[model samples]
Target: MSEIKKIHMGPAKCAVDLGDGSERGEYVNQDYILNKLGRPHRAVSLMYCYYPLDETWPARARNAFKDKEITFQWDYPYDDYFTYKGGIGGTTDDEPFTCMRDVRRHGQDVILTMTIDPNVTDEHLEQIGKELSTFGRMQLRINHEATGNWFSFTKRATYQQVADFYIHAREVIKKFAPNVQTILCIGGVEHPEKGGEIEMEKEFADAVRATDIWSVDKYMALHWGWPFDVADEGGNSFGRSKVADTYNLTKLSEKRYRELCGGVKKPMVMSEFNADGDVTGPYEQAEMVKEFCDMLKNDKDQGWFNGFTFYQFRDRGRLGLEIEDPNNADCGIEQPVMQTYKEIIHDEYFYPEMKSEGDAQFPVKLRWGGSEDAEGIEIPLHFEKNPTFCEITFEDEDADLNLMMEINGKWFYKAPHAKTIDFMSAFFEKPLESEADMTLKIFAPPASGENVNDGSEDWMLNTYSTITKMPNIRIRFAPILK
Candidate 1:
């Protein structure tokens, strides 16, 4: 047998767009992947169009997704672009904020596609910076695919204006949330004439200074062919360029980013990646994913590539890892690529164990149900040493959900919601000053909007009743300061 190449470098982590963050789609697919498929991706991706007029456009996105379903005047007038100063604080009412917090609580990162108008002001950037400051490390991709014809931002703003907005936004956010990495995402280099005719180097030159990562949203369209006919063309479904190399196009984009940034190296990410299933099938997509992973592992600049977020987990067509079942998104029929991808990601190179630098993460599943659960379940926490600071996180739990925790029968802590509520340090200083073992009485009260008047006494029948529904509940302890 030819010598098997020793796998050296690969993505430190991987993510997937669980699909439709605005609705229950992401939660459904996330549950399916974690509970059914058993994929251990450390991050989740979602998109947001920063339309400030409705005030509830992004906030109440969970209401509906279809354009036709929207009851309010949703579109933001391009010429009358205004600063979105709302949601500065991490309000539980904010869907995106809660989702991001939930992902972080579950020991996963978030990739937010915060599509915005190019006319954002310094004040607006500062507001966003403050909002992001409360969040953990996240990849914030603003105005993705600006060089493409799809996004509205590109149509309204010039190339230079786009670059300027990125530069300013990055500069402002860096002051507050340095952990939030601004990603300069663009289209692939396969067919420059198709949408991105402007030289990327010239286009993104000014923004490079602020960009923490370079990214390209590429699909193996050459091999699979476009799913839809090219718009403005008379039923032309063919790709614009003769070249049909997906891997080469990705490399070319990376090369351009490197050259454009004046040889300064920055981590590259495949922000949105998938192979269309119009021509072949999941097998072709599987091959594409395998080839992409192999390329990253074998490349001379191995670790230079950070990671990739799969285009989707469940969508309308075979474009996703599974064909979405309209009635039940979580119960979609798994595509062949799903199995292949699972095997690939389970490899040591692709799925490295992640740890916080200065924080120790302890995962605990707390489920309350039986009649005995009324008095609350006492869960014991064992720490190697006394933790100076601590934060408890509940995954996807309602914001108004209350959890009562009585520590050692001396200190009592009631968690109002899932957001960061620091109570452990106070308890840590009290009776458990030196003790490493502490007992916590965990119980959930009737949620905020629950119909207590029904008087069924089946209090636990609410959201937090089952472990499967709220799996990833964790307690993170920060290291003592020097």
Candidate 2:
């Protein structure tokens, strides 16, 4: 196999809608957001500012920087027909529009999204594109709905509008943020009102390729609600033979996503993904994060491309959580999910196999064996460090041995016979000195009463001797910390 490529792994910033920061009360405090965003392996914040022009917008922007937050701005275009509660929508008519300016003035990095609108004239788009280019690192947001009226677009509109929007947005962005990184398609169909949304996404992605930006999303979900709830429905199965809705959707989404963007040269991102604290069980949420990490690691192994982001940090008021004791309105830290992200960031044991010499010291032993008659045996061996030699002995006369060994949870060796072992004990040239766990598995074939199945009748295998830190084992050390 070829060498594995390492991709940028991090958490999404601003996992919630900032409504002027006032309605949030003390719940929307900086410390809370910081703790959540920084807890991930890679720190990021997801933001959907209602109106960048509002005075409060800059205050929010400033607060984000103070927390060292990575901003992902969800830009809603100019539309007079809609009234964004926090004075956000209709970008052209808004005044004091300094949100992006504040970010740049503060020397902060940001991801500006252009939520495509059909009514945007070529000149207007050109100007918007110029502003984005000047800002640099801006991402275009493509939605199935029309920004012109904030409603679902017709099939024809979905394709033509998105295709045209990308062509124009790309032309302008190429001139401005030429090195601009990602182009995200917001609101991937959970349940497309019209089935055409999926097809439209493909069209938009194809267009985005011409511009050189990677493709991604704002939010995507597989299962949307808690168990036994009315809103429970799964989205983005990712072509798994058996759909595990409880697992994080990012993995499944990315699998299907690669299929969708197969020929494209750019990577993708989950840009936004998470369950409402109230709806998802704590342990389930943590499991989802683990699944997300597993997906990334697996993708790295397979040589696929892209990145990922967890959705808004705190759940918006739209979703209600049943209070346990009611001490604080804040959902008491979404422990399971939060811890999962923390583990992903802080824990180095995500994959059992050790990649570097420092990690090899911890070896885990896996064991398995049994008689051919009816039952089997399995044992787990823990090692203080990597062993110089491993020996397996069988006591049962009719036992057929099938044994295997693994280092750091990865398969390393397998042997058919325990006795005729006349080989130099397999050892790591560089012996690990720290505690580790290795797994050994033994399988004894079942016996058929007749000779038609060979002489093997009753089979039984067991480990009689287990040792760590053998006398002849040599130690070589290279100081990792200077």
Candidate 3:
């Protein structure tokens, strides 16, 4: 394990919410955490540790991050929802300003998840606006997990009430923190009871309809703590979320969330995901993580998921899927799961360049050409080493391009297969012929009607170009080894 541990000395890579959201400096210790695992946390989420998401004590909180990104989440002392009271913190309203000021000095981005009760006063809303204005470019998720019954805002409020609150929050946050990224988040899907005041699916759908950037808290496990129906009905099962050895991505998935968002098109993240309670030995745990990560990596609707953070870094009671080497004899520095994670963090797709130091980047350059150049879409590709797979993305998906890529001699196809690619992205996993130069040809109906079976080919060719001028392409090389 010591030999395998890799150093994570890059910008924040987002592994958050460890151990009941406390501010104790235990997990924040870098040298100690590095010894236990291969690297330090790219992101650490501290939930409700400070009443106002306090970042005032830089000397104290800064060390925990060790220069990593910070995600601070907490419920405001807003007594907006008054039916059943939870311990609402006092007006630590000034805390965010203090905390964010310290975070800016840390030189990393921050994600702030703030919750307000139903009885939220105008003063409280105004304070939040000021905080965002002060914080600047943070990802602010208001009343996250709005679909769940746990939080005060969501528990008693009707779905309409939650939706209205979310709309208002977004408006307020934007008015102040023009640079802030407002996010809509929900607890994992739930069975919307018949005749219930809240319709989890409809409410979530409505919320995302208001904004494109959304977050969800989902765990891939054998016995899910929540209804499998939410997943089943939504027609989305992100890999092992259907439990071990099952994946039905088409019907229910992150796509369903995307579908609901309607038009706002920012990439989203699985703010909380992992095998939270899946009982597993070391190898099984490794497989679980590997499978799920692979699914996200290869998702045809690739852009829909920008990134994912394991449910937690340390542990919170029985839901403990701590990334750290554990105290139990069954877990150790030799744990296979940790090894898998170390390898995963090394992947460029996950950490990119500035986020991790796992591997040096292979240089890539692109030359521009008119849309009608060459056969289909002219794609030049080369992979000189192992793990040659890459993710191909487009800025527009308005056309039906049965895009096919010819690598070496064989061909690979992207989705929606023969159907239109409604989403703007897809994965390219064509195997490189053992380091030989590789070229990928992505074509809409061939410009030359030579391959056109009928007028449909000519029509399709003309149609794609007209749908949108050749769209922009973005590809991410896989950072991990095969």
Number of the top lDDT candidate: 1
Provide the TM-score for each candidate, comma-separated: 0.61, 0.44, 0.50
| Per-residue lDDT of candidate 2, residues 125-241 (tens digit) | 455444344333334443322222233222225565656665665676455434344454533333333642433455555554453433334322333222213333353321121
Better of 2 and 3 by TM-score: 3
State the local distance difference test value for candidate 2.
0.34
Q: After superposition, how far is residue 152 of candidate 3 from its true place, in Å?
A: 2.5
- In candidate 2, position 405 carries an lDDT of 27
Off-target runs (Cα >4 Å) in candidate 3 are 1-43, 49-107, 187-201, 222-253, 261-264, 318-336, 354-482
For candidate 3, the TM-score is 0.50
Per-residue accuracy of model 1 over 1-482 as CA lDDT, tens digit each: 11111111113443333333322134343323553334335467776666543444433332433343322222223211122234433343455665564444333456777777676566667777766654545668888776765455776678778877888878887786665778888764656556433256576766754588888877664222222332233444423221136666766677767766678888777887766554336677677777777776676765456677776777555567777687865567778887777667666666633221221122323332211123234444665555555555555543444554434332222334454444454444243545476544444433331212244443213223222232232444565467
Compute the lDDT of residue 122 as modeled in candidate 2. Answer: 54
Leading candidate by TM-score: 1
Q: Report the alpha-carbon TM-score of model 2 versus the true structure.
A: 0.44
Question: Model 3: per-residue lDDT, tens digit, 1-482?
Answer: 01111111222232222221222112233223333433223333333321222233122233433455432211222211111111233343344333433333222234565666545655556656554443323566677667665454665478679888888767765774455666777643333233222236665566667764666666665323222223233343322445332233221444566555554565556665556333444466677778877775675755555655554445422233343344552332334555577667656556422211232211211111112121233334545544423444443443343343333332334333233222112222234345544344443322221122235523211223222333333333455566
lDDT of 1: 0.53
